[model samples]
Target chain A: MSLIESTATELLGQLQSGRTTAVEIAAACLKQIDRHDAKIKAFLRVDRDGALARAAEIDARRKAGKPVGRLGGLPVAVKDLLCTKGQRTTCGSRMLENFRPPYDATVIAKLRAADAVLIGRTNMDEFAMGGSNENSAFGLTHNPWDLTRIPGGSSGGAAASLAASMVPLSVGSDTGGSVRQPAGFCGVLGMKPTYGRVSRYGLVAFASSLDQIGPLGRSAEDIALLLEVIAGGDPLDSTSVDRPVPKYTESIARPLENLRIGLVREHFGEGLDAEVEAAVREATRVYQSLGATVSELSMPHGKYAVATYYIIAPCEASSNLARYDGAHYGHRTDEKAMAVELAAQRKALQQTGDSRKLEALDNPLIRMYRRTRAEGFGAEVKRRIMIGTYALSAGYYDAYYLKALKVRRLIRQDYDRAFEQVDLIAGPVAPTPAFEIGEKVDDPLAMYLLDLYTASANLAGIAGMSIPCGLSTGGLPIGLQLQAPPFEEERLLRAAHMFQQATDWHTRRPELS
Target chain B: MSISREEVEKVSLLGRLLLGPGELEKMTSQMGQILDYMHLLSEVDTENVEPMAHALDLTNVLRDDTPGVSLPRDEALAAAPHRDDECFLVPAVLGDP
Candidate 1:
């Protein structure tokens, strides 16, 4: 086993025992990153000096016999979407490439309070838009399992870094399967905490309602530990749940016997790969052997998840992204040119005997706004923004945006009904395993389909997890998904932990080193 | 499901994104194909259903309308790409007077 395979709990135990110093373990991870990051390209930027200094301080505290928190001294990889004070928290977008925040996100603050070493920011899809890390303006983050294949995304780099053994635990955001899908492809545990279970104050927005911060790690236990520190209400984020936070790590140790597991029939339909279905079936058998009852559950509304998500996510995205229009916080261009070039041209056109009254040509502010946005965002980002703008536009809001909202309601209702008959839902995280780097890039629809099984959780605001169940025939990893109703993350974790105990797939590490 | 290059250009304009003629053609085709796949949502019955915006059952969680701490003017303006004395300056958005 590689040093990266060391679970967060085991590493914490070693730290408390004085068998391993924080500096030693952190240096080891940094060395591994230096040795292997070139081929993997998992990191957007590594805070070598900051990380080392922090580790040294923690080591000093340990030597002084100072009390440390549960995850003290362990390194954690953070996806680029989470804001880190004084660090360039670029959300894989050129628009904010140099943007740094004055305050730390609530999750980052909690991790620091727990003494978890902040290692670095991982790469991701620009603005968390694509299914593959290929959308990142910095570079693509390769899957450690197969360098040529994608690591899934927009949390692709976080999953890759963990799978490559650069870090034991990493944090990622899931707007639509960003964490879980990549976690599956990288052969790790990725959890999308129930919406509002974790604070979103520091996370850069994608789809406001759909966006969530999650943990990606080697196993359910590591995620459980991270979630404990990160979960709870924060005054900084109004959306954070004020409900009581459960003892996640303790709950994960609970046995899974006589628990009802549902297999969503729609998820295993025609498009699913034979290998993926087989792996999910095998996982179901394991659950059955653990004294759990597995039953096939019908979720006919699940067939519309992709469609519903596309409309709803974009509509939210268009509004959330409106804050970046060459104003208050982000990139802005030259003013003189804006007045002389764009403004004068419009003025001249308006002065002329134009028949259409230069309605579109009348407003130079609008023109400048258009040019700035056009220059700033990528293709996929632009497409979604336009679709959203159109959906919410004057004439079509009732037909497109409002109708999508109603459908989203039906979709959630379907899950609520399903949960009535079963304690949790189980299926393959994705329809297939990881595809090639550029396989679905040209086909946006095909890329969106990758979230077929995962987006429903985001839509319904329930907890979902992806754990490595088996490997595909093509040598890529497949994740078996287990979902629970709101605030039932403990149950979801328990079921996943039981399945993990019966298999060795979670222990398998990609040979990136 | 079918989007043309002209439609792509129009959409790009609406989105405030500049796309070259070539990119417009490519994106139109790509988005069309993607939209075709997304039409599956229409297959479900959504009649008389109330739209769900958020997952949590709680509502009206907005902060009270009292004044709160605000960032210093200079500190907020410090990160702007371009700035002037006492304010974040951008190209005159209203155009020349």
Candidate 2:
């Protein structure tokens, strides 16, 4: 197999045995990206020169008998949302089109320290808002499995890159089901570690309370390896827990015995595609046959997760995004141009004899702010900001934002109750597999429903992962989701690894040109 | 739960965003539909449940009170669209402050 097709674990063994050099691996990945990324649109920017330079440095260090870091020479793609010093971190929005951070995000620093070569910045939903990558300002990322379909988003680019064999590993942030849903659609492994398990200091905030950075890779062990490097506490992010990082790679080989997996009844009811449900059920049967028990369970409040997330995520987003006001950083409106336009509008109103219209062009400062934001953000982003602003406004906060928070609590309570009976929850990652690229673009609510099965894990701040189960009749991949209580990522990875070992789903790759 | 053009305008103003004439109508209806869907949360009985601000029950995560290095001025100002030396430039805040 070519270097790009090998898993990170296999590449590591070859690197240690001196059978392959870091430069060769980097070149292979770069070659694949150069050859295929045009059609996949998986990356916003590819750092060819930087990646090659870093790989050569690692190769030289190895030759000089210097200790190499874990993940040495491996090419990793990063979601554009993460801040990388001196590199353009657009967050998939025009607001930060040319913006470059002066400091590295905690996770980026960790990856660099581990000797991983940063290959490129992947595309994402603008500011990580939309359920599909169609919201990206750059362009939508097409699924490598089928160019006509969308690789579920906002981490669609990361997952697509993995499916296309452009990179061995990638990092993405999950706000709702961004990482896992896309991973499922693209037929790979994606994990969202517990909220505080991974630092969020440099991840462009979408919904601060629900967002967590995680890894996407071809295999469960690959995901675990990336997670081990990125997970841990940092003084920069106070919300990051101070717990010791577990050896996720070591735990993946442990036997799966006497495991109690809960099959959520609500997830299976109406709206779930028949093929996806069948694949998930078959996965459960496989687990049962492997000396594990599967029981029917219910989280009654699971139905409200989408509603709660819509309210809370937007409310937080309105506040988090308020920082881009054309002053400090990001796109700024031209004051002279605005003045000219306002003067022209006032003159036109004067000619039309409309005093009210003339009087409305009063506050130039406010006009500048509004015009800048209007021109900077996209349609979905504006809708969200407006929704959040209205939800948090006076006389409406208690009715909307507060009510959503209360319902969020009830959702968590539902999970708390269910966890008392089961060790982990298993179900469909999304309602369906990959859909046509433009299928749900016009209907926002229809797109939101696609996240029905996955958003609850984010709302409850638990660990969750999506592993390939089977393919639909249309030849698209389906994913089986495994969710665990907060901070139990090791268990989540182990369960997924055990399932993967017994089945060949995770081993299958899409036939990409 | 039905949002009107006037309400959308008000909310957009609050969000510091200007909507085009056609966008106003679209946003009003879209926001209405989303709000109608979000109305499902009101159906759930959350009267006694406390509001959850965050998933993990964290409170006042404070760090040591010490001076630390901050981003250098040049690098910090590198991304600014409009900036003067040592400060970001903006439209006049007050007419004659």
Candidate 3:
């Protein structure tokens, strides 16, 4: 196999055995990115010089007989949301287009400690606000499978980079299906580790409670290998749970004996495409053939997932995004223009003898905040913020935000009850394979529906993953989603590993030009 | 089942997004439809259910009161849109300056 097409584990094995150098691997990945990244648009920034320099350092360490880290110079693409010290972390929004983070996110630090090279920053929806990467202020990421379709998002670029053979591994954040849906669309493996499994210390915040940095790669083992390095507690993120992260790669081959997998009845009913439904059902049979018990599990609150997520995610997003007011960092309005406009408003209000109105009009700071955000954020972002503000506002708070939280509890309870009967719940990752670009961009409701199957996991703060299961007739990839209860990543990865062992769907790569 | 333009205008003010006429017209209808769809949550009776603010039930993570390093001032101001060497620059908070 070409070096570019090799998974992270395979490349690591070769590197450890001295069969290939880290510079060769980094160069191969960079060459492929240069060849096809224009068409794929998977990356917003590709650090060719930086990646090679770091790889050379790793190679020198190996040559000198010094210890190498776990990743050992493997090139990994990072979603633009993760803060890399002295590097631009735009979060796919114009609001932070020129923002350079001064500190590495905890995961970046962890990856660096493990000797992994962060080769590039992948594209995402602005602040992870949309299901499709079309919300990205930069540009849409085209699927490697078919250039016309979207590679689902807000982790679209991360998944696409792997699918397009630009990198063997990538990392992204999942808040309401960002990681899993894109991995499904791009026909790879992605995991949203149990909420707080990974620290969110320097991850650009969207929905503070729901967001978790996830790993995406070509196989379950690759996801597991990366997940082990990035997962754990950090004092920096207070919300991160203090728990022991299992050595997932060490025990991934051990399949659950007499495993019980649940298929939600609602997932197969409506909206789910016939092809995706067939694929997941076939996967269920594969588990059954492997001597596992398969049963129909009813997560009764499944239907309410999208609604609950829409309310809760947007509310949290509005609160989290409020920090980008142009005061400290990020995009700010020109002060000269603001002064010009403020003087006019002040004079107009003074002529009307309205001191109270003049007090508001004369405040250039408030006007700057308004104009800065209005111009900085994109349409979908603004729409979400407006909706969130409306929901969290005085009279509607109880009706919208509060009601969503109660339903969120109900969703979690559904998972808690389902886990009582089964070890894992299986379903189709998305309603369908990737839709064509511009298909749902203008239709906000349709775009939100793309999160239908995936968002509930975020709401419940459980572990969820997507692995390639089948291919559509049109050559698109379909994904089977497996969800596990909180902090059960070991089981989740093992369960997904079993499917990988049984099938070759993940082995298939897209015909990238 | 409808969100009025006036209501959306109020929301824009609250969100700090100064929407123009065209965006306002479009957002009004879009927000209305989204809210209309969100009304689906009302069907499930939750009068007795408790609100879940976070997924994990972890409490506050506190450490010893020790002074440690924070982001250096120069590094903190490095990305600021408008800044002096020492502090970030902003428009006058109260009135013209």
Candidate 4:
């Protein structure tokens, strides 16, 4: 295999065997990003010189027989939202186009300490507010399978890069399927650990309660390898659990015998593409053939999972995103340009002789906050903020935000009930395969429905993953989702690994000419 | 359960964002549709259920109250759009004092 196409596990063997060097691996990844990224638009920025320098240091350390880190010489791509000191972390938004973080995110620091090469920042939706990369203030990323279709987002670029073999391993965050859905769309392995399984110290918060950083790679072993390095608690993120992270890499090889899998009845009916449902059901038959019991289970509350997520996610987002007001960091409204508009507004207000208008609209600082955000955020962001603000607003709070939270509890209860009967729950990751770009761009509700099967995992805070199961007749990829009880990623990975061992679906790569 | 245009304006104000002239109409309808879809929550009976704010049961994570090395001031202020030597700059908070 070409250097870029080698899995992280394979690359580690090659590095340990002294058959290849870190500089060569980093150069090969950089070359692919340079060669293919113009058409894919998967990366916002490429750190060519910095990555080579770091790779050289790793190669030198190995030559000197110094102790090398676990991920000693691998090249990994990071989603743009994670802060990397001195590197521009755009979050696929113009607001942070020039903004550089002063400190690295916990995950980035972990990657560096593990001796991995930081290839570059991948593109994502602005603040991760959209289901599609179309919401990116930067350009949208095309699916590597078909140039006309979306790769999926707000981690579109991250998944596309993996599918195209631009990078063997990449990291992304999921708040309602940002990672898993795109992984499914691009035919790679993507997983969202139970909430709090991974630290959120430098992940740009989308929905604090729902967001969790995850890994994307081409194989189960690669996923398990990357997960162990970035998983584990940190003092920096208080929400991160202080629990033991099992060596997922070692456990994935030992397949769980007699695993009980539940097929969510709601996921099989309505809106699920026939091809995807057939593929997922076929994956179930594979599990049955492997000495596992497959049974139909009903999650009555599952129908409302997407609605619950839309409310809770946006409400949390409205509160979390309040920091970007053009004050301390990020984009600020141009003072000189705003001065002209403020003068015109003041004149109009004075002419109106209205105290309410004067009191509410005349503040220069308030206008700056309003204009800065209006210009900085994209359409989906504005819509979510508007909905979130309205939901959390007075009198309506009980009707929207509070109600959604209560439904969220019921969704969790449903998962807990299912776990009593089964070790894992299996379903379709997304409703369908990657649709043509702009197909659902105009319909926000249509886009929200894309998370129908995936959002429940986030809402319930369970470990969930998407692994390639089959291919659509149209040549797109279909993903089978397997979710486990909270913090049960070991079980989740083992099940995915076992299924992958039986099917060649995970090996199918998109032809990215 | 459609939110009115006036309500969307009020909500936008609460979010500290100002929609441009044409944007208001488009967003109002878009938000209205989303709200309508979100109304599906009303179908479920959550009368006895408790609201789950977070998935995990976490208490306040307190640490020792001691001074620790912090990011250098210049580095902390490096990305600020408007800043002085010591503090970030913003428009006057009080109006026409």
Could you tell me every candidate's TM-score relative to the true structure?
Answer: 0.95, 0.98, 0.97, 0.98
lDDT (0-100) at residue A427 of candidate 4?
A: 92
True-structure RMSD for candidate 2: 1.5
lDDT of 2 by residue, A339-411 (tens): 8987788779899999876766647778888999999999999989999999999889998999988988988
The local lDDT score (0 to 100) that residue A270 gets in candidate 1 is 84
Worst 10 residues of 1 chain A by lDDT: A355-364
DockQ winner: 4
- Residue A416 error, candidate 4, Å: 0.3
Rank list by TM-score: 4, 2, 3, 1
Off by over 4 Å in 1: A334-359, A362-364, B1-13, B36-38, B62-68, B95-97
Reference A-B contact fraction recovered by candidate 4:
0.94
Q: What tens-digit string does per-residue lDDT give for candidate 1 at A1-513?
A: 435569877888788888888888898899999999999999988988888899889889889988777787899999998887767888988778788886789999998998888999999998998888989989888999999999999999999999888998999999889999999999999999999999999889999888899999888888889988899987887788998888988878889667999998888888999999999999999989889898987887787788888888998998888888676666664556656765566667777957464555525555556666766677778878877876676776876777778887887888989999999999999988988988877778778878889998999999999999998877789999989998888998888888888889998876664
What are the per-residue Cα lDDT tens digits for candidate 3 across A1-513? 889878899999999999999999999998998899999999999999999999999999998999999999999999999988888999999999988899999999999999998899999999998877999999989999999999899999999999999999999999999999999999999999999999999999999999999999998889999999999999999988888889999989999898999999988887889999999899999999999999997888989999889888889889989999999889988778878877787778789899977655525777789999998999999988998999999999999999999999999999999999999999999999999999887899999988888999999999999999999999999999999988889998899889889999999998876
Stretches of candidate 4 off by over 4 Å are A352-356, B95-97
DockQ of 1: 0.58
